[model samples]
Target: MFSKACEYAIRSLIYVTEKSKNGERVSVTDISTAVESPFAFTGKTLQKLVKQDIISSAKGPNGGFYITEEQAKANRLADVVSLIDGNAVFQGCGLGLKICKENQPCPLHQNFKEIRKQLKKMLQSTTVAELAESQATQKTFLNNINRN
Candidate 1:
């Protein structure tokens, strides 16, 4: 239902958010080891997140990636999602039919249309700071998806 890269990106962002209050600037190696992801690939995605200003970063010793309080407030879940996954998640019809629309509804269209709209709205509304606080306090587990 979701891309692994997108999932990793968000999870990593949340991890950054959780550590931000402590001013933890973690290295790529540390982040991947902590997040249980591939170092090189996740590093590239983190680079994009930094370039996009969805997260903050630095280079060299005692410098790496760390979210700021401002960055936590600035970034929305949809922004991270769009950065990693493009516009497809918000654009596609939920029904299997390619032509499912208001004029031509599929069986699953009605069921999906409302939820998809709600999901998009929720994603648009929430931020990493909000999500991180909740996720950190709870017994959260990372989920894996089949990659293409």
Candidate 2:
């Protein structure tokens, strides 16, 4: 599982991917509404993402969050997760051991190792643009995290 911040980051990512087209941008309020994320918390998450270059933003009247062409293409879910959560979610022991290891395997090591690996692959392999393109017509699950 991921933290609220991580979830907010992912959802905000969905908002940016859906609304911005490499150059286009939207206000924080729009992003909050689209992603059903809290303003203060999501804003904090966005600020960190901006610092990490996982996302981009601008100030002033016409300024807002947007992504670059290279960023649009290169930004993966893994990067966002790493920015917001580092490797905490994926690196922890699946069996909740005090300090499980290869020599001292957890009870569920054999069962969960492969699944965690697959999840990582899924997250790291999926790009923001890819997810946006896939959800072009249907509901944007990532973007519509907010109810309104």
Candidate 3:
């Protein structure tokens, strides 16, 4: 249900967080490849994240993207979704209606409303560090080919 940019942002964040645990910075190219996203798209998404302070970056030979401990701990998946996609996820009509609401429900409104509520809850409850730790422990794989 996420846009390609949002998908890449989530993947990049998880990957970067895993790397950042070791005090390492990851490049755009690395993030793109790891997340299976195009380099340019990944770069743009990273820039947005950087601008939003959802992630941080540096410049120079050793410069790249890395998330601070505070950032990882404080930020949630919901924050990334909102930054990249706004409230569209929670506000949009399920069947593409311009104005679907409880009083004037669409065909799939009730089901979709429940789904959106669950999604929002999941996003709010999930932290970047939690996902990063799952990846770092090899419980989850970022790409088709397992790196760990």
Candidate 4:
């Protein structure tokens, strides 16, 4: 339900968070490779995250993206979603109608309302730190794994 950029942002942030726990900074190239996103697109998405202060960066030879302990614990997936995609997912019509609203509901509007509410709650409740820990411990995987 998220845009490609948003997807990349979430994955890259989680990757950065995982590395940050070990006190490492991650280059955009590394993040792109790990998340399987296009290099330039990942770089751009990362810049947006940096601009929004969802993550931090440096500018020297050793400069890269890293998150603070406070940020990892405080930032929610909803923040990234709001920054990259706005509240559209939470506030927009389920069927992509430009004018759908409560009074003039789309066919799927009523059915989708509860779903959207739940999604909003999940995103708001989930911290980047939790996802990073999940990845670090192999409890979850963000990128596809090739069994072959």
Tens digits of lDDT, candidate 2, 29-86:
8888777888888788888888988779989988999877667679889888888888
Clashing pairs in 2: 34-143, 35-145, 35-146, 36-145, 36-146
| Residue 73, model 3, lDDT | 93
What is the number of backbone collisions in each predicted candidate, taken in the order shown?
A: 0, 5, 0, 0
Positional deviation of residue 64's Cα in model 3 after best superposition, in angstroms: 0.4
Name the candidate, 2 or 3, with the larger lDDT value. Answer: 3
lDDT of 1: 0.81
What would the TM-scores of all predictions be?
Answer: 0.86, 0.87, 0.96, 0.95
* Top candidate by TM-score: 3
lDDT value, residue 48 of candidate 3: 93
Which should have the higher TM-score, number 1 or number 4?
A: 4
Q: lDDT by residue for model 4 over 47-86, one digit each (tens)?
A: 9988988899998998999999998999999999999999
lDDT per residue for candidate 1 within 1-148, as digits (tens), equals: 4588988898888878887778789888877876788999789989999999988888787898999888898889999888898876776677546787778888777778777788789999998888888756664544442222
lDDT of 2: 0.78
**Runs in model 4 with CA error above 4 Å?**
145-148
Tell me the deviation in Å of residue 23 in model 2.
4.7
Model 3: residue 97 alpha-carbon error in angstroms: 1.3
What's model 4's lDDT at 119? 99
